[model samples]
Target chain A: MLLFFLRVINYKKNNYYYNKIEGTIIFLSNFAPMIEDKNTPKTSLSELGEFGLIEHLTKNFEINQKSTVRGIGDDAAVLDFRDEKCIVTTDLLVEGVHFDLAYMPLKHLGYKAVMVNLSDVYAMNATASQITISIAVSNRFPLEAIEELYEGIYAAAKLYNIDVVGGDTTSSTKGLLISVTAIGHANEHVIVYRDGAKENDLLVVSGDLGAAYLGLQVLNRENEVFKVNPNAQPDLGPYSYLVERQLKPEARKDIKELLAELEVLPTSMIDISDGLSSEVMHLCTQSNVGVNLYEEKIPIDPVVISTCEEFNLNSTTVALNGGEDYELLFTIKQEDFPKIKANPNLTVIGHMLDKKSGMALVTRANERIQLKAQGWNPIKE
Target chain B: MLLFFLRVINYKKNNYYYNKIEGTIIFLSNFAPMIEDKNTPKTSLSELGEFGLIEHLTKNFEINQKSTVRGIGDDAAVLDFRDEKCIVTTDLLVEGVHFDLAYMPLKHLGYKAVMVNLSDVYAMNATASQITISIAVSNRFPLEAIEELYEGIYAAAKLYNIDVVGGDTTSSTKGLLISVTAIGHANEHVIVYRDGAKENDLLVVSGDLGAAYLGLQVLNRENEVFKVNPNAQPDLGPYSYLVERQLKPEARKDIKELLAELEVLPTSMIDISDGLSSEVMHLCTQSNVGVNLYEEKIPIDPVVISTCEEFNLNSTTVALNGGEDYELLFTIKQEDFPKIKANPNLTVIGHMLDKKSGMALVTRANERIQLKAQGWNPIKE
Candidate 1:
């Protein structure tokens, strides 16, 4: 019976024909097979009750954030964000809708989920200090799977100078769903809002765009190829930059520090999540301003350009409408432009206009086009 | 075509045949049918973009919390929870596993979702001030359905004096899932924890128990009957109290203020989400004490006892094993008992013992039984 159990566990791991039974796997845009590395042993989540599961998963997480009065192992996390203004953001990532586990590893998914919430925190120019993660998983997942997920969360928590304060664990009926809430703080004077931009503020963005979205496209393409030919191991060396951006996005935790060092504060800020156009419009609309977004000045990674060309796609459009680039987009005073002009990480993509001027995208051909919030809408898709 | 759409939607609302297609619906324990009232007009979620949906749903929410600097329509909600200690708790509720919409109204589900998080906040003897709700729903739901959900959430927030701070709206591949993060604040001196109980402290609980669990059973039973006979309108008159306890459970928000009025500080506090025995065990284990829970002293609603008899189940067993009773359980110094003795809402269940004695239930027949934490485990079930 012990030998039989071993064989069954091992067989469960390497079930090549698991796709037939994984019909419920929900990936956005396509149906992807649920696949995982099959070398490890499995422990059903049933072995541990909810409290025990939370305790086990969170035992390794060290509570180092000074603002965190108490971390896990309590009914609620206690935080002391004295004097500074507190900011909160939350997002729910349903399996298949917000994430596709077929291509996204459990660990990466965990890390990315944290990154997603932290991005919003940083968008407020706040120092992210604490986060609470709650997840619901079906019994199909083993204890090891959740452990891996928490490991990623711990990794993010450690690197980001944040504490995992509190969370909940429960069973889902279908697949895995993760909800992450990030809490951050900023001195009232330094905090930026999307409604602060004045006319003629310099529109700037950190890092690059289009890479994360293209990375997803590459992953999906590779996934499809593997679906058709399971033996194929396509080279991913060239698309590493894009794939990394998609699978393991790092929220711009350093941007606030960088701006502080330069003695420049943003007039208005928003994160580039639902594509550049969508976020840009939100910023300008809220600021009671418009923007002239220069197509030629929009930052795009070299790999994104080459990958777009290879896929017969437009890099400009990808940069405009492809979301999931966890980069900060903000407007600085024109006087501060000189301070950030030489910075390699910053790009002046556009300048703000008066609200009556209406938002527009300045094409490379010098044609003006109105901004549309046609970002990725899961419902529409 | 318009008529066809209406027919489809109206049929969808009262979907008798919908059960066959809803095999993926994941309710905890037994399978429950997907049922809904049929009079409302349906608007596809696809009609509104994600941001638009959030804006529309939150349009009516008034930002009444003084700490709220900025509510929705931003990357994050800004607050000013200064000198007071801030508390945060979160929970993820998945469709089917955590709820069955067949008997649970969308509005009630939304209200209960908020209450679940608030219960944890109040457990700390804090004032729940803000909440961020993130939900992922499939296209199978209409915009009106989501609106109904938000209405319930709005009602809860209004009554609880909480500001709907920030959240994310996204599409799910399967059924609906909601994640709520509640933020509360308290003076450091007044905040209660789960590790402060003394050996001689009096163990107490607010309100009654077992009704919520019995309510679920009643709903599931009625669901089965409705499945067998589409026209069987369940006359829930007798089970009204149980049904209300199950469906629209009010978190013990008043208990904290009431305790203050009574001038009794609970040494250790925990909310009873699970059964009485399970929570009692948790309180004891965390506090490093043992408990002598008098079975007869355990508060049970008269209706709950009658319903248990009707279902041919032991009331004590149900009170010990049945979960989802959102009552406040705490321990206070023996000197505080007289202050709370005459309170109708509060009941002294038992007393704490030394850790060496272990936890036990003293039955009416004078038999001592070790407390078993056999509360609901969705994964195991």
Candidate 2:
């Protein structure tokens, strides 16, 4: 079934076989161009070489985080996070398995790649300060294509106040791949882990769920429509929110600061990358607790409900199983609930339970369905 | 021309295409097996799932570093270096681009991958502490195959006394790729950078050069021989050192301590990753100092010299242009020369000169030849 989406678009004798797996791509390349526009000049990557490519691409990056003692030019990046405990996390994005470049713009892809890793750092409740981006690209990618990718990466670093410490850039055999490692720091007492939730802790989530997944749905449908007719320009006004969520997922860097201002330290925390249910299961399994998640309490955007109806997808299921939201999911103490209750950015979704009670979602009609982690493990399928 | 090395082995109706790019692959998978070994049981990776595969692979990886506050099973790994500064380095090894499984073993590839990154950390004059490994594998890799790869990773971690802190595992469309992020720490005063060398400093290098490159040549030659004659068991006793250097190169972790013991701090340092010439040019460019490298002073193992003679290649050229030596090259004040003069492990190959003097290789015959960086950039070729 996955093979059905693999389409090849040959341009200038360059064959790009788009392998669309269930992945939100970070394609920061400008490979996609307007048809019949031969004015888009292309320079071969061979002209720049590896070192020249690295220097040219990274010359514009500025170090904002003081923790980064040295970046780029050295064999390794030197970081001084002071006395604060350091948090490190990494994620790899493969072209065929994690992205569909047919519809996904390369610039958004680069921004999303950095955004995904920062989300993990914020999930640790630490202040993300530095990142290393290593990418493997095929020779088909010109120097200009990589420049577009780096532009997005530089923009993300500048806006998020993170430093691009160091990275490796090499050629891949067939396709493009990106590996990003994010480093953050925080005081020992303020740090949070997934294994700390108490039985009665209230489950809280920032922002709505399922929009990113819906955005992917919209993108796939549009891409299909385009493949059928190149000139077709379907209005995407209604699906803009979902499409934006899918393409340019901003990490919840503010959620950590917002929680601090509210004076509510979550007992445990995780990022909503692989849908709500999967993240909830991770917290419960790691914390040795159960949760009573209210399906109605799931904070989803109005557009998500309306779009889900249009696509014949159950909105609750989408929230529970639609991955790549990039929102923070955590459990706060009941007393701290009063502090976060009136916040528009926060939503109280459920309450933690004893291990034996198990994880279940309470339906609007009061029906109880056992929760299961439906993480999109494409390798398994 | 690269297409000449690509070969496919069809077994069990599965097509295993070997893309032999000029890279040392960290395969760490038992994908290549002894012919007619049908008894070798194989379990599909899908059976383990993403989380299960991670848990199973890392179950044996015991955290050895004190800096690792938390390893695996979290959103991010927590590390505390206390007053010491943190050093981070990352490298991505892609199959086809980096290594040819036709000759490289999975275990050695895994160890070599970690070794390659650790070399960068040691070049910074820091203590290698922790590492995060992120890998993407195709469905072709079975559970047992990846287990072999991890065994090598675990072997390297255990031997080097580093912690396997965190990582992400996902599927790739084809082949296997491993990205290793090494984190280390050192006191502020002791940390070194590549831009600190001054004119009149003595240029030095640890161990010999060109052996790793010769090792690859031997392997590639042997692989071609094997393709023609499967039953032939050619003797490799003479090239053991070269083969070992290529397959299991060790990072110079003890150099920093040794230098400290001798009270000889390097003015600037870099690792021999892109050959001696490229690295020297970088030091000169960054530190604003030129170097007069003596050709006769180059320390080459007898095996490398013999192999170079057999291959009709110039030993000096190989030492200068052949890379992946994993040796640390640095410069020290002229006053520190006496301290290291008696040490057999360290070799003084040249002297730093003023920027106007320019980078040159003073040949054994007394001819001064201008030096140029001949980094093996496969992308350009």
Candidate 3:
């Protein structure tokens, strides 16, 4: 079991899979599967209770945000941010709608939940300091299961150096639901909104897009195959990057740092959670500027391209409409281009045009077409 | 129909019932049944879309918090609190777990949700300034139904002088889930924690107790009756105060103000949420002290007492263990008692003792008994 666990780490540092039948964390290996026996005990949540469960999970986390005066144990967390304005954003994710537990690991679910909120904070060029996670889970889950969830939450919180403040934990009537509120601070001079883009401002995106969406497709396919044949092993070696992007996608915490180091401030910014096209449209609509996005310049990872081909889907379309990338899309002044020109992660996809240009995308074939926001609406799905 | 709507207000200011079958909000009238006709139009959520639905719901909310710089319509809300420390708290409410839609009004649910968070902030002797609401609803809800929900949210926000900042609206996999995050500000000197209580400190409570819990009992009983007969009209006339306490319970926002006016700062404070007994235990455990609460002094509303008798429950027991009162419970210096002695809403119920003394209650009959926290655990319920 130890050797198999080490082998699983060789696949991904955080790739531990949950064995539903045995109700334990394990890893798949070529030699033998790592599964705890069914006789292993599962601690009921009622045994620890709500407050005890919260304390048990959050005890390992230390408050490090300078603004965070108190966390976790108080009726309300306290903070003092006198130097900058505080930015707050919240997101709610419901099971079956925002995620499918069948393919999504609990730890990855926790990490992704935090990333969703932090990405919004970074979009405003703010340094995220604190987050409160509110979860409603049914009795179907054990205390150990919630521990797995919070382990992921702590992993993300530590990675981003944000404090885990106070939140409420309640029983849900049905499936799991997660709500996260991210608090950040930003100086008035450095703050950015979606309405600041000017005509001719260069549109730039950090990192490649669409891999997370394709990764979801791969997981869904594997899930279907597993449902059909429980004994079949999923060989996810080739789609590691894509799968990681989907599972443990990182927020653009470094992008703000890089921009500061390079002395470049974005005129307008938004994160690419609802895909590039929707985010671009939001910037355009808010900033009163149109955009000319070249199809060839839209960043696409090699894995995403190959997977798109394998799935018989258009890679460019996938990049345009595939959601949950958690990448930053911002418009910077043309004069600032020189500072970011050599950066491997930064890609200039387009330039903002006058509003009368009507939000068009100039294709590589020299044809112009209007852009539409095909945002991920799980309600419809 | 218009006359019935007007009558609903005469019955109670926000007396509106949800028709589960039609998935619409209708005013309840004692004279006539509120069943919707089959010909009534039901607007699909797809018609307004997500963005349109949000805009329609939040357009009426105005930013009133001086600290709030930007609200709604942005990636994140911005707040500036330069002079004081910031306080943050969050709560999650799930349908069937926290409330039953059969009896609870959406607007009341919204108002109660905000009260839950604001109560926490006030417990720290902080002034709440801003709130963010995130909700996940199923397709069964129509645009108008959500409007009623937001109507209640805005009503609470307006009454409390809190700014409605940023929030997320999404589709739920099952029932409705609402999450609220409240932010407040306080001077470091004024801020109090649960661990600040000391031996001989006077323990005081604001307003009356047991009414909210009794109100829930009234609602639940009426719901059972209504379930058996859809046309049954719950007179609810005599139990108005109890019902209101459960539906639109006010947070003790004025407790901080009252304390300041009386020139008596609490050494330790906590909100009475999960029953007075549980909250008292929390304070004692955190402060490493014991408490002697006098049952004779425990504030119980006459209506609650009468209702407890009607339901065959002990009024004193309800006062100790009934939750959702949203009242302020705190410890103040014994010398400061003279300042609040004349205040009708304030009751000096007990005094703190050394940790070795343990927690005890002195009954009206002069009998001393140990106190136990029978907190409401909806998970078990």
Candidate 4:
């Protein structure tokens, strides 16, 4: 099935590659062109080195967070949290394993890295305030490449309204590695953890799922087709949403605000980074409860379903086990479900059960099957 | 000169390699051997995978910090800083670039990773309360090896009285990469910055310098010898201090406490990760002051001096340009110099001057020479 898509893409490449590329160029010309200096001399990283590269990339970032006492150029960035409790989380992204630079733009990579860490902050019912990004890159990456990467990072920081604080830049032996530490602050009373879920709690999720995974599949297939035929200009309009979800997924930052406005506090919460099934297991184990996940209620997009059919994979399976959704998954009291029932962004997918009941998925046929955590595991070959 | 030392080491190896190893074995037998379960079943990382591995490694880490409210098994670690200001700093350490596993024990690597980041927190005159350590390793590493690495990390967390908050562990494309983020807290009134120095401030450094560099040289030489002949047992007793300085370097955690005890606040402060000259330049540029550094007053351990002489290198040059001392370098008012004069651990080697004057070193020959930041530049080929 994947080979058929590749063949179709290759056929389209031979027939309409140039015209499609021209259309894309015309489309992109509407926006401000990204600054790419072809005439500028390529500076060897050794000339500016680690400290200089850091100073150049981070020089423009202003400390916007009132809690931020100091930003870059210090041993440590200082923040005054006052009476608010602080939340901290870190994520490490390595090339070849976590991302393929061939199709992944450096800018998007930077934005996604920050988003992934910030998603965890939001999952805790906290507002992210600051992040420190430490990157190690090989000599293969020119200073301009690093600048482009930081531009994405700066854009994410601005969009999220967070401060770019202190970080270390060093030389790597091979490939680019980025580690982001996000700091957030929340009131002690509102902070949530995964161990607070109770029986009869309604399992709710924000936004749709499985699009990111299918998007990755589409990109992978397109990349394979391109490898075979370099002139391939695969029509990506149909897969644009999925591709965007894969390359530039956003954290459900507004969900916390919405929940606050609705006066519904989650008993237990986690972000869907490793698929809904895996995250459900984590929540259930931590909260010492079982879950009854309804497969029909799993919010998957129509595009994802079509793509999954084209790939000969089950949409339900993809939605259950596909990772990197970055959506909020939490359990609220059954009585609180009414507050979120009218909201289109959120869906009640399941409900918590007693520990003796065990975690199971109720299918459309009304048959129950045990759930397993087959989420994306990069450790496997 | 290096060849002569290698020849001497080879000659010693030819004569007493086995006997020396036997003696070393006897010496090690006196202490508890590190836990190594080579005979046990080897489990591929794929068996437990990422999440399981994280849970297995971090399960035993008890939260010791009062600031930490929620740790591990959560979207993000939560900390209650109350009214205190929080300090954050992050560092990236790549395998071949920052460390070599041949000589660097994984435990020491873990401990050193924590120390390096905590050093920055101390440089800010704050008390470190928590840290998030993210590591990426290639498949070549076994589950046991990762356990050993975390053992060192757990040891450091215990010794420092800090909580292990949260971090990500992922698979790297090639070598190991560790990024650590240290979070600290300090009263708003006592925090220091690098831009606060004024004219006539006394420049002081904690402990001696260049020992870490010399230690690296020793390790590199020993590694080269081992590569040529694995059985060779080079006598390291004479260079033990240097080797320790490199392998198990400690952050000057006591400096902040000592300064508090003496009631002297640093006008400007920075850590000597990059050699003294580079850090001095940072202070001068940030603080808008020049400095007159007395070469004769620069502290050097007797072992470091002898090692430099043996290597046919200038002790003053080594002290000035060598990096990774992890020592605090700061300036204090001239009036406060008397308070630290009797402290053996602190050495006042320079005094701040007006911006009109240039940064210079007064040599032993009574000649003044402009200082250069010829520190360790790993980016250079």
Best by TM-score: 3
- Candidate 4 lDDT, tens digit per residue, A205-314? 98889988998898888777777776565777787667777877778788889899999999999999989999999999999999999999999888898888899999
**Residue B229 in candidate 4 has what lDDT?**
71
The per-residue C-alpha lDDT of model 4 at residue B28 equals 19
| lDDT (tens digit, per residue) of candidate 1 on A24-92 | 112323322223346656777888777778789988889888899988877899999899998999987
Docking class for candidate 1: medium
| Candidate 3: clashing residue pairs, number | 0
Clashing pairs in 4: none
Error of 3 at A115 (Å): 1.1
Would you give the TM-score of chain B in model 1?
0.90
Q: What TM-score does structure 4 among the candidates reach? A: 0.91
Per-model TM-score on C-alpha atoms = 0.91, 0.92, 0.92, 0.91
lDDT of 1 at A177: 86
Tell me which of candidates 2 and 4 scores higher on DockQ: 4
lDDT of 2 by residue, B1-381 (tens): 011121222222011111122333222123342222467667888988988899998999887777889999999999999999999999999888888765666666788889999999999999999999999988877777787678778888987899999998999988889999999999989988999999999999998899889988987787666567654544666776677677777788878888999998899999998899999999999999989999999999888898999999999999999999999999999999899998877999999999999999999999999999996775675
Fnat of all models, as shown: 0.87, 0.89, 0.75, 0.90
Error of 1 at A282 (Å): 0.4
DockQ measured for candidate 3: 0.67
True contacts kept of 4: 0.90
Could you tell me which residue pairs clash in candidate 3? none
